[model samples]
Target: MKRSIKRLVAFVFLFLALNNTTAQSIPDSLAQKIDKLFSQWNNPNTPGCAIGVVRNDSLIYAKGYGMANLEYGIPITPETIFHMASVSKQFTAYSIVLLARQGKLRLDDDIHQYLPWFPDLKEKITIRHLLNHTSGIRDQWQLLAIAGTRLDDVITQDHIVKILSKQQALNFKPGEKYSYSNSGFTMLAEIVKAVTGQSLRRFTDSAIFKPLGMKQTHFHDDYTEIEKNRAYSYQRKNLFTFSNSVLSYSNAGATSLFTNINDLSKWVMNFYTPVAGTAADIDQLVQKGKLNNGVELNYALGISSDTYKGYKQYSHSGGDAGFRTYLTVLPELKMGFMVFSNLAEVNTYEKTYQLVDLFIKDTSAKVNADIRMDSSRAIIKDEGRAKNFTGDFISEDGAQFSFVLRNRKLYWERYGNSDLLYPGLKDSFTVARSPEIKFVFSTTPGKSVLVNQYWPDNKRLLVKYATDSIQTDNQLQMYAGLYYCPELDCKYTIVAKDHELILTSNKYNDSKLKLVGKDHLFTDYWWMRHLKTISGNNKKIIGFEVNDGRIMHLRFNKIQ
Candidate 1:
C-alpha cells in the first residue's frame, strides 16, 4: 500500500507539471486576432500580404496570407521579397550620412559643386535642403512627363540635372515651406555618386547591406538577374485574377528596393543599436531637424518620427504600381512590425498598427494628426439645392476627376478611367473597384459645389476638394497670355485651339484642356486640372492655379 501511494503521488505531480508547461508554451489569444486581421486580405478584392512582428529582439510572429503570384499559385511568405518603393529613402539618407562622416562630402555643400551642370536657381540650394525637402526643386517625375519623357525610360542623374538647369524658377521659395519632392532625394543620390565614385547600388551593398547581413536585400537595378526567393509583384483583377508588372530600377534612391520582412527586421534593429556607424553618426541620421524658431520639421532625414497615442513612434511606408509596404518601430517598447504586399490595394499600415497594438495592449493607440481623418458630418436630405451642385469638378493634375450629379447620383473617376461607381453611405461616392477611395460632395453658392476625395489608405495624400462654379467663361481669347511665377521661375503661355485651351510650359508639350467653367479646365487625363483667373483686376485675368495649391500669377509686363 505504501509503495502504491508513492507511485500515485509521483504520477499526479508529473501530470500537473506537464499541464502548466503546455499552457505556458501556447501562443496568446492575440495571435489569433492577428491571424484574423491578415485573413481579411484573402478575399478577391484585397491583395495578399506578408507580416512580421518583433518583440524585444525576438520574432514573435511571422506569416503570409493569400498569393504572392496568383497566376502561378504561389503563396506569400515572410521571406518573399517585394519592392519597398519610398521606404528606401531612409536607407539612401543613411548612405549620404555615412559618406559625410568619411569626409567625402558635406551635407551643407551646394549641389552644383557635385553636379556642375545643375540648374542655376536664383537662390543657392544646398545639400541640406535636398535632404530635408526644402530645395524648392520641382518634382522630376512630373517634369519628365511634361517634357514628353516616357515613364519607363531610364533616367540618370545627368538627365535630372539637365531638366533642373533649364527650369526658370522653383515651386516655392527655398526653406520657406515643406513639400515632398522625389527630386531632392534623387539629387542626394547624385551627390553620393560624385563623392564615392561608386554607383548607389555598390556603395549601399558594401556600406549597409553586407554589414547588416541583409543578404536577401538588393537595389533591384536589373530584372534579368534572377533573384532567389523574390516575391513576384501582382495587381488585382476583377476579384479573381492578379496581373504581374515590372518596375524599373533606375529609381534606386527614390524607390526600387527589393527586400523581405526578415531583412527589414534586422534593419529596424539598427535603428535601436548602431551596427554600421558610431552612435553619434546614427543620432545625426535619425535625429529630427527643426526650423530656425525651434519648431520640429516632423520629418527626419528619411524616416518620420512623431507621437502616436502618447508614445514616440517612427515609421515609413512605400507604394508602387504593384506593391505596397510599411515598417513601424516602437523603440521605447522594444517592439517593431513590418508588412509587405505583392498586390496593390492592401492596407499594410493599418494592419501593421493593429498587430503592434495587440502586442503592446494599447487599445487607445492613435495615428498622427496628419494621417487621421475628421469624422464626416451627418447627411441631410437634399433641400432643393441639388440642382445648384450639379457640375463637373476636376483635379489640378488633370488625372483625378469627379462629377457632382448625374440622374440625381454622384460619381468619381480615377485617372479618367471608367469603372463602375460604388454607393457611399452618405453624400459620398467611390470606385466600385477600389476600396480605398471615398468622394464627398457638398453644395455651395451661385450654382457652385464642393467635392472632396478622401484616400484613407494613403497617408501622404491629404483629403483634396474642389469648389466648382458654373459661371466660368469658356472663351479662351480673354485667358490667353504668358503667366509667370518668379518664385518658381516657370512660365505658362495659354493659347486657344479647336475650342480648347492649351497650356504650354517650358520643355513640355502643349496640354489640350477643355474649358468646363469660367476658370476651370478638364483634360483627357483625370490627374490634371486647372483653375484660371485666380486673380482678377477689372475683368483682366492675372494668374492661374495648379491642383497642389501652386499659383502662377501673370507678370504685369506680359499681361495684355
Candidate 2:
C-alpha cells in the first residue's frame, strides 16, 4: 500500500513537469488561439494541413490539424510529407546560386552558352534573367498544353526541351518585362546539370537539404520512388476524392518538391542562419529582378519580396494537383510561417498570413478610405468628353485595350471581355465588381492614354492607337470552321449563331468571341485574351494562334 501511494505521487509530479514544459514552449492561451483558428480543419474524415511557426530560427509551434490520408484514417502530423509545387523554385534557385559561388557559371552569361541546342531567337537571355523570371520565356505548362499535353500529363524534361526548342519566338525581350515563366526555372535546372554534371535532385540533396538537416526534404524527381509518410493529395469536385498528381516528377526545377513542416522548418532557419551556403550565396538568392527600363521587380531569384501588413515579407505560394502550400519569412523579425496542405480547397495563402498575424503583434493601422462620393458630388458627368475617349490603346508590351461609350456608359474592353466602368471623380472610372481597379483617362487630345490604376506603383499605361470597330457577320463567318492545333493536339470549333461568334474547345467551355481588333479576338476569360487569325496559302483563313500572359503564339490549323 505504501509503494502504490509512492508511485501515484511520482505520476502526479511527472504530469505537472510536462505541463510546465508545454507552458514554457508556448503560452497555453496562445496555443488555444492557434488551435481555434484551424478548428474548422480538425476532422478525421477530411484531408488537411501541417503548419509550423518559427521564432528566431527555432520552430516554436508545430501542429497538424486534420487527416493526412482519409482512406487509411491517418491523421496529419508535422512529419507528413507534401508536394510543394512552385515553392520548389527557391531551392532550384539556390542550386544556381551555389553554382555561381563555385565559379562554374556566371549569372550574366547567356543561357545559350550552357544550352547550345536552344534556339538563339536573337535575344540575349542571361542566367540572371532565368533566375529572376524576367527571361520572358513562355511558360512550359502552357506550351505543353498547346502541344496537346494537359497539365496532369506525365511530362518529362525531354518533352519540355523538345517543345521549347521548336518555339521560334519569345513573349518579350529578356529583362523587358516581369512575367512569371516556369520555363526559365526548368532551364535553370538544365543549366545546373550542364555545369555540375549532376541532376538537380542529386545536387540539392547533398548541398541544401543534407547540410540544412532537412532529412525529409528532397527534389522529388521520380514518382515511382517510394516515400514513407507521404500525404496523398485530394480534390473535391462533387465529393472528396483521392487524386494522384499526374505530373512527371522527373523534372526537378519548376515543381516536383516533397517536404514536411518539420523538415521545412530547418530550411526556413537556414535563411536566417548560414549552414548550406555562404552569406554571399544567400544574397544572390534574394536579389530582385530588374527591367530593361531600370525598374526593379518584386520577384527575386526564386522567391518574391513583398510587404504584409507593414512587415517586409519574403514569401512564395504553390499549387499543383491537390496540393496547396505557403511559406513566408520576415528576416527582420526573425519569424517565419509555413503551411502545407494536401487538399486543394484550403486557402493556404490567406490562412498562412492569418497564422503569421497570430504570432506577430498587430499595429492596429488602417488604410485611409477614399471618399469617391464626396469628391464627385460637385463634378458634372461629361458625356461628350467620355465619347471622345473612345479609341484602341496599346501598351509597350503589345497588350491592347479599347474604350467604348455605349448607352451613356463607358466600357473598358481588353482582348474581347468588356467591363463597364462607372465614373468616379473626373476622367477616372472604377470597375463595379472591382472598385479598387481604376481607369484614369488623359484629357489632352492626341495624348489620350488609359492608365490601369491597379497594383500601386506598378500602374500600366495604354497609349491611344486609333478608333476600333466590331467585326461584320461576313468577316466572322469566313473564319468559322473546325481548327486543329497540331502542337496542342486539340481542336477548336468556331460557330456563328445569332450574329455572334462562339469559340469552343474540348479543354474549356464555350466562350463567345469579342472582336477587339482587325485580327485580334478577346473572350470573357482572361486567359483566352489574345486570339489572332492566321492565314494559309492564297490568304485563305487557315487557323488562329492563342497567346496570352503565359502562352505565346500557339497556332491551330483550319480543318473541316
Candidate 3:
C-alpha cells in the first residue's frame, strides 16, 4: 500500500509541473491580439511602439510594433531598446530615496546646499519640492529654446543651473502648489551627482539597474552608439509615410533611458519584492505625502499614485520627439502594464486605462469599440460664420488665445503664440505638440461669436467671443493686475503694456495682445494667444479662463 501511494504522488506532481509550464506559456488568443495591435501600429504612417505587460512578476507580454528604423527596414521586437522619457524620473527619484536611506542626504535639504550657484529666488526649495514638483522653477526646455540652444546639442546639469540663475523669480512660493516640472527632476539628477560624487547614470546603473537584474537598460546620451536590439524611432505621417527622427538622449533626468519590456517587468517586480533597495527604501519611494500646511499632493518622489477603475494605480509616462511610453502598476492585483512606442501615435494613458477597465470591470467583455477611433483624422470644427469667428477668444482660466482671418481661413493661436491657419476646416485648427481643436459657432445672428471647443481625449466646451469693444473701467483695471493660481502654481501678470494687453507667464518672456472685445484679446504666440475673462457681478471680470479647463479667479491677489 505504501509503494502504491508513493507512485501515485509522483504521478500527480509530474502532472502539476507540466500544467504550470503550459500556463506560463503565452496563450494563442493573447498572441493574436498582440499581433493585431502591432499591425495597426506598424503602418508606415504610425509611430512604432514597444509594449510590455507583467503578470505576477513575469513578463506575459513583451513585443514591439512597427519599425524602429524605417530607413533600415528594421523590425522591432521585445528586445528592442527605446528611449524612456520621463519614465526615468522614477529611477532618479529612487536613487535620491536610496541615498536618503543610506544617510547620504535628506529630502528636506535645500537644493542650494549641494549646488550653491542656484538663483536667489527667496524661497528655500528643498529636494522634496523637486520630487513632488512644488518648486516653481521654469522648464529648462523652454529656456534652452529661448537661449537658441539646438535640439541636438548636449546640455549638462550645470547648463541648466546657469539658465536658472539668470531667472528673476519663481512661478510661485516654494511648496505653495504642485505643478509638473521636468526642471525639478533634472536638478535632482544633478543633486545626485553632487551628493554621491558620481555621475547620475553610473550610480543608477550600479546601484539600481544592476542589482535589479535589468541588464538591458542603460542611460543613453548618444543615438550613434549601437546597442543590441535597439528599436528605431519612427513618426508616422499617414498610412504610408514615416519619418526617421533623432532619438533624444541628451536630457537624462527628464528623459533618455533605453530599456525594454522584458527588463521593465523585472523592474516592476521590485516594487513588491524590493530587490536593489530595502523594503524600507521601497516604502519611502511610494510613500504618500502632503504639503506642510496639509494640502493633498498626488505625486510621490517619481511615481504618480492614483486610484483608477477601482484599482490603486502607480504609474508614469514618457514622450519625446518621436517616442511615447507608459509604465503602470496595480499592486492590489500584483499586475503591471507597460507600453513603449517608437511612434507617438497611440495615447498610452487612454489605451492602458481602457484595458485595465476592461479587465477589472468586465473581464468577459472586450474594450469599447468607440475608443478605437483613428486620431489622425479627428478634427474639431466651429459651425459659425467665418467672418464672425475672426475675433480673439481667451481662456477663462487666464491662457491667452487668438483667432484671425487670413485668406478666408480661420487661424487659432494661443498665448501670444502664432496662429495655426486652417485653410479649409472653417473653425478647426491644429496646434503644435497638441491635438487638433475645433470651434462650433453659436447660431445667434448679429451677436458676439459663441462657439463650442473640442479637445482631444474626448473633452468639449462652449466658448463665447465678444465682437464689441471691452469696457475700460476701474473694475476691469482691478482684474488687470497680475493673478496667480496657487493650485496650478502658475502666475499670469496681466498688464496694459504699450496700448496692448500683455499676458506673461514664467515660461515665455511675455506676449503683447490686442484687446478686441469685452473679455477677449489676441496674440500670435504658439501655445496660447487668446485671453478671456469670466465675469461674476455687474459685468465685472472676476476671474480668467483658458481653453484648457484652467480657471484663475480674482481672489488670487496681485503680486504687487
Candidate number that wins on TM-score, 1 or 3: 1
Superior candidate under lDDT, 2 versus 3: 2
Candidate achieving the largest lDDT: 2
Top TM-score: which candidate number?
A: 2
Segments of candidate 1 deviating more than 4 angstroms: 1-28, 43-47, 150-161, 292-294, 363-527, 531-560
Report backbone clashes per prediction. Answer: 21, 6, 41
Collision count of model 1: 21
Tell me the tens digit of each residue's lDDT in model 1 across 1-560: 99998787556534532321111221768656777887666532334787887766555667677666554545566777888988888888989999889998888787889977676767878877777776777776666654455555666655666676666667666666566777788777778888889877888999999988898998776545777766666676676566665554455677778888778877777777768776777677767755433455767787787766566678888887678889888777777889888777777888778777776654355545353322232122463554443445554333345444454443444455554444555556555555477666665566345666655311121123344432333546677788665533556677876665777766556778666545555544322344435645676677665543222221222344
lDDT preference between candidates 1 and 3, better one = 3
RMSD values for the candidates in order, in angstroms, are 12.9, 7.4, 15.1
> lDDT (0-100) at residue 14 of candidate 1?
46
TM-score of 1: 0.68
